[model samples]
Target: METDRQGLFRLPFKLPSSAKARSVGVYIAGALYAIGAWSFFDAAIYSRKANASSVHVTFVDWIPFICSTLGMIVVNSIEKNRLIQDAMGSGSFSGSSSMAWQARVILFLGFALLAGGISGSIVVLILKFLVKDFTSYPTLGMGVNNVVGNFCIALSCVVLWIAQNVEDEYSYSLTL
Candidate 1:
């Protein structure tokens, strides 16, 4: 009777069929980190060429860079966790499945684009307020782009946190 009962319970909730789904978040986080790191390097190079770069890094750049790096670390850690491996031993989160991962990739890209747009608009507003001669240089556009990219990156870190939590909840629910 005990064995029969155990089988009955197992019928409704078996191990996840695959581990493939949970990787969506990992991949998205990895890509964001890569892009942010590349941009940081690019900015450093450009600043060197201009010779106008500040010897002291401003709060703006430093904060976002740190946050993005942390986000990358989190993603890597999640990928390495044993629970995740066990869960996938049955099946992965429905959301992390191959189709779901693809959807997530699209969603991440959309977020990136949205963040870029918002950041660009903000930088333009700042320039309009601070620069008396706004139309003087072509480089102002580049400056604006940089500011916006950083803003987007920082914001994405917050989004990533929320997303990780959501994924955890979703994974738990699937197990039940």
Candidate 2:
């Protein structure tokens, strides 16, 4: 049987898949998430304090961000071993199957929330800001920030996932 392939792309440069790289990826992901959160916060503040237009950031504008943050937390908290072993059909414990099932369910929910957040952000931009004739950059920025913030959050999740998977594979390589 042919073995399964690994890594999305083979790079010309050999990047060390070390623990340090994993740590850096995690830190970068966190920073991206923070930037996303701050972007939304800045938008809310600008709307509250300096916005001359009637358009202001409201609770409706915050739902997407909340969902994204919660999703990130859920996605990052799952133990990777469970997911991998489950797929590989290696169960040492009686409850391993159930644990894997739970992990899958939770993981699915997390991804759903993440996707929903991105979609919701776009919806808010179009329905709440654009439709209301908030054409000027200053006023429109509120919605734009929401979309950008959610996108950054999604990117953060991707970085974290790649980092985690790479770390696991690195460990496997060492064992072999």
Q: Highest lDDT, which number? A: 2
Query: In candidate 2, how many Å is residue 166 off?
Result: 2.6
Q: Which 10 consecutive residues of model 2 have the lowest summed lDDT?
A: 86-95
On TM-score, the candidate that comes out on top is 2
Total backbone clashes of model 1? 8
Q: Candidate 1, residue 93: CA error in Å?
A: 25
Q: Which parts of model 2 have CA positions greater than 4 angstroms off?
A: 1-15, 90-96, 168-176
lDDT of 2 by residue, 1-176 (tens): 84444333465665546888889988999999999999999999999999998888989999999999889888877766666555554433334577777887898899999999999999999998889887899889889999999999989998897677664344643343
What is the TM-score of each predicted model, taking all chains together?
Answer: 0.39, 0.82
- Which residue pairs collide in model 1, if any? 16-90, 16-91, 17-90, 17-91, 18-91, 18-92, 21-96, 21-97
Q: Give the alpha carbon lDDT tens digit for every residue of 100-131 in model 1.
A: 45544544554455454455445543644236
